[model samples]
Target: MNAPSPFSDMLFEKREEQAILTDLAYANGWMLDVDGCLVKTTKAGGAGGHAIGGAAKLLDWLRRNERKFVICTNASQRTVATYASHLRSIGLDIADHEMMTAATAAGETIARAHPGGRILVVGDEGMLEAIRSAGLEVTPPDASNADAVVVGAADTYSSANLNAACLSIADHGAPLYTSVSSPWFHGGVKRSIAVSSAIAQAIASVTGVQPIVCGKPSRELGESLRLRLSGGNSQIVIVGDAAPAEMRLARGMGAMGVLVLSGATQADELSGLPVDQQPHWVVQDIDELADQLQRVIP
Candidate 1:
């Protein structure tokens, strides 16, 4: 398929980079993003969300091929097992160890920063579990004292919780960590704000401390990916729609960053941006991308 713009044209022309990715997937492995890139937000024309599409087939093929593969997501509300269960429930068919999420990455990063740290976490049971796996304890603000504040998607966020988190961070000189800070994404007709970014902004405004984000473009997720792949950064490929986060991550870890036009970033969004802001290959979606890869890899 032809690229939508000249910026995309330049991105595709870098055959040297493309060769490396094709070689990597053909030889070692590939990493994929779940939302938008693989799963559609809504059922189309009577098909449910669980409908097994081309992307799911690709995932199956990866498993069959026995090449290293992992699902790297910025969604912090779920544990790795929960993410895998959702995939299986939705008919995607993936293993628990095959998933790596920002929630897990953030917990790991915070654990390293403050050893045996007390964490004031805002999220579901999954977030709590991920933190605990990394050797950290979690608590609600008023019930207990904590050494740091960890924010993500939560059903219990409010003015009181925000104020309490800020106070904890301020009093203990604890570092603040957030799983993600993305603004919004399209869903049906309306747009929804990412919970992590909203909570991070609120706490920063009140406490005057910028929370350290450990997902998406951050190295924490990269580290998790590194472990799951076990093939090092040179053989991994990061695919996504957002340039700012995924692209920065690819560059930082010497991985191939492939972007598709199936989600948040429209084709025209790449105009006048530097080369670093573009993907290694711009395609329509995972289906077309898989077809393209067949030609390049073989």
Candidate 2:
């Protein structure tokens, strides 16, 4: 398959004190972004998504080759099990263990920051699932007191829920945790603002407290990815479309970053970037790598 842009189609790797892609098969593990990389999902959490850019063929290859990989998404609207099911329905069969969400990081963060403590949640079932899985208790939406307030994506942003979250933080003098602080996440044509960040900001403004970010570029999810995919310093390659966040994360984790234009990024956005924000390798989309991997990984 031909790449969308010649400038990004190279399969080589070298860095001037910066970066490069690990020869596909050499890396012990891979971290793939979900929404924009493998599939195009609507911003509405859990909305329908379709596999794109040779996604089916590439994922099938990974499974057949027994590649160590994880599908990471910042979407926190559903549980891991639900996400796995959703992805499978879209022709991308992802297992629960191979999936990581911002909610998952939130769970880990809350567990470590406030273990066994009750907290108010402003997200969806997924957020609650992650928190509970980490052995933390969830307080009801109407409850006024809690150890902390956690926010993430939600289908509905009700007044009652907002008030409860505020009270939980104000009454208990609890801290606030948000899955992501990014105002916008890529999705379908009608781009939607990140409800989680909006909620977090509202809570912050009302309570006069700062939020502890728990999404990409945050060490919590990075540590989780390392523990799940990396085996004691084994190489990791991350392929995603988002800028700064995805690339920055890869840099911080000492992993190779590969950007696919098939998702949120465009050619114009890649101009004159700093070394720290540059992707090790740039391809038109997943199919470019798919074409490369077809020749190499097998």
Candidate 3:
């Protein structure tokens, strides 16, 4: 039913190719890996999180082996603690410390760039807490002394709030930062627009100050993850379904890209990608990927 994979000559069947490619991913030594959002959340989409196939097994194995990996995601609706707890409830053995989120990245970035500065955040309660936890002061939208604007996932947006952000950036000369660049996300039954991007764009249009993104595909998050890794020239592998987030992260970090079909991306989409943008390996899901890793690992 499917055309032979372009990698067939060197690796044979899909299963074999998956194993070989995963092996190659770790060939340089240890691997510093990050997963896409859908790897933990349901592909069908919904308000909460669920473990996908082999998610628990793969994460457990990695933890038991003390492998270097993190579940990096663009979902900023909840705090990292909430997501970690949700994953654990779904049988995935993940800890809060093992997760990297866009909200957290945004907070850290803002703190690094301007410590103790006043940040006006247009996001959920979770995002607000994350920024506060990072040691930056959170200011209300109407605050006149705001030093920066950080946008994250919000359920609602009002023109008044947007105007405040614009004023902060344009009139006050404050910088703008966004949690993620994605325009939308899978909402279980359908794709829903990402309010963060909308808010960011609205303010950017008015202020003409493009946002500094602090999520996946941005080197800010990648640099944070790199800090957690054991010092070495170890190769990294970014596994995800979203091409723009995970694949772009791989290319930026000089890491291998692995695309799983159990999420937002479909098989047909692979053929249309440019060679440089294409993932190094395409598999059914994380289960298949874990299987391949098990076969090659000593």
Candidate 4:
């Protein structure tokens, strides 16, 4: 037999679900912040690709109603244009500007910290391009004069890259930056430690300088979104699967958090979390949440 859900008092009950969702719809607007909450990849860690489900329908409905929403994600493996193309391939029809990514956020953060300055990036081609797109000069990791070090997703990391980053921070006194701080993420079938996190950890160990994260759960991303969605009186709603990252992001932004079981987090994990860390709503998936929204938002 399964144990009772601690959220039983707040969720699934008909009246309470209606009441909460109603208030959510009435808010200034909603932000469907994480990709994992809406789409699932075919392979572990999105190595394969993505597929859309009920979340696509939800997006269409929101668009038809002229509602304000953004599909924000922390996956910084590619540029926003590439991610948008990937979504289009899956028939989701998302525009590049409609999405916010950790890559873009990292770029924006770096630009603000050291505008037009050279940055040593330790990541993949996508991360390098993102930094460049942010209007900052990209220096090779070995560049001794790099003003900062920005770390992101990188499948190929070497000792040489690590050494360059260390030298940049310790010797050059360059600040260290990262896309996301979470050590691990839910790839479709299993959890994997983020390449950026691993590299950041190694650099911090050597230089004794912690990285400033610019992705989810960091105020940087939230502040970026706040600027993007200015002149809004609606409340913000963050829906995602990861607890440590997405839930913390919602808390940091003072937005409503909805957890779906289709991604990283499982129902059993909720019991172990602190009361404050718990999501305000829990559902089986985006489809179920959409159903709830349809019933209450009209």
Candidate 5:
């Protein structure tokens, strides 16, 4: 009859973690994770594959609560507009600004840390583009002029690149910034080195300067999303594929979390985990998530 709070035992008990479905009834809207949760991975086609089980329904729900649905994703390679267009072509008409990426988070962090400094960016064009859009100059600077060494997913973080960044950091004392430390999932295949983790390790090894990570599980990402919520933490919901990142975000922000077993995490993986590490809601796929949200959110 009544909506369940995030603290309910039926959902988040000590060893058995179930999806906290009732929490959705009270939320303003939801923050849905894109990629594996919604769009099925394609080889190169624009939009030919079928939508993930709940993706279509989720899109419908978003259409109903246009202001409430925010698409937060870790895909750092593209701008929000590009992502919005992809969603649109797939029949999910979400606004550009509604989509937040790790690139944006990394860029925002760089802006806050150094207002107008020369950046030695070590990521894809998307990462560089986000930095430039944030009103900061994106150019290779002299060692002394280099303010910070920001790294993301770039195919060319070679030894020379690392040495250059290390020199800038060691000589000019530039702070290091990275997009995230998680594994890169491109079309469902995991990459060897996460750019964030690699650059961070390189910075440490060369200049002995630790990097500041900006994406996922980080307080910055959570706070950035929290600011856009309809209400305070109580009315916010975080839907994500990873446990460490999204669930940590939920606990840190005091928001509800929905973990879907579509991407990185598996069903067997949940059998033995502590309560604090568990999600409030666990579903087989995003389609089920859409049904639960529609039934509760109206």
Candidate 6:
């Protein structure tokens, strides 16, 4: 279980609308989640994804106001450049540098701790690219001298890679890193199982060692995101659909957590939770967020 957040008493409510308006107006940077908050894949197994309603316009407004932000995502099935092109095709004004992924976060975090370490990767092109780009050596699944094990939502997960991750962590104690623990992500217009979480869990089940998630609410991911912002975000608002990821991230950092109903989660699900487990605010989508910002900003 998560320790109670220091901001537990600071949770937002509709009656306290002024509090959020104040935060939004003064926030120096923003960290936005991509899978559900901003875009959704068209089908369960589609090539690319589509931007949410008014996502492009919302991003444009942020840029015009000179607000520092990054499109943080847990999905690393595709390269950042490839994902950027898909966003562009959907009319979003996103550049390659504006995006960050779980693979990227894990690579950066692992690199600083173990520079030039040998990493066993159970992922695809994007995950491989991230680790290699970080100056880490990518060893095959069955390598014995691996320094760490990094897992992503791989399209080619099999007995071979699964055996390698389990052995590396359970037997070698190499440590396990995963993208996100969320079980589902938006695919097209529906929710689909997130494979990486399943794979990580299987290894943990055998090893009795849980994997460290490196996306969304993870500080490892947050550090990577803050570095991307022009000046690190002193005040931030984390907007995303999933609570276990984005909401926990906000609580950990004392940032405003905004739950958008445009993704896997919905309004009906916000029944009740500890102050630390809930969002600071809730909106239907970025369109509503834009409306809220319009009311607050000069």
Provide the overall lDDT of each model, using Cα atoms, as 2-decimal numbers.
Answer: 0.71, 0.79, 0.71, 0.77, 0.70, 0.77
Tell me, by TM-score, which candidate is best: 4
Q: In candidate 5, what are the lDDT values of residues 172-273, reduced to their tens digit?
A: 788888777765553232323455666667677767777777877787777677767755643788787667767777777788878888766678988665
- lDDT digits (tens) for residues 1-298 of candidate 2: 9657644444331232222233655677888887677877775333587777687777788888777998888889888888888888877777888888899989988898898999888889989999999999998887778898899888798898888878777777888999998888785233578888888998999989889988886777778788888555878888888776678788888888888887667778888666766887888888887877776656
Task: Name the regions of candidate 1 deviating beyond 4 angstroms.
Answer: 1-21, 42-52, 158-160, 186-190, 231-233, 296-298
lDDT of 4 by residue, 1-298 (tens): 9889868755668677777778766655566754467667633223355654687877876876667777777777777777777777776767878877787889988898899999988887767888999999998767766899988887787777778888989999999999888887774456667778778888899899999999888988877777675533447777888878778777888788888888888899999976546798888888888777777663
- What are the per-model C-alpha RMSD values against the true structure? 5.5, 5.6, 4.8, 4.6, 5.5, 6.3
Q: TM-scores, in order shown?
A: 0.84, 0.87, 0.85, 0.88, 0.82, 0.87
Model 3 RMSD to the real structure? Answer: 4.8
Candidate 4, residue 18: Cα displacement in angstroms equals 2.4
- Count of steric clashes across candidates, in order: 0, 0, 2, 5, 5, 3
RMSD of 1: 5.5
- In terms of lDDT, the poorest run of 10 residues in model 3 is 29-38
Q: What is the Å distance of residue 41 in model 5 from its true position?
A: 2.5
TM-score of 1: 0.84
Residue pairs in clash, model 4: 27-234, 28-234, 28-235, 29-234, 45-187
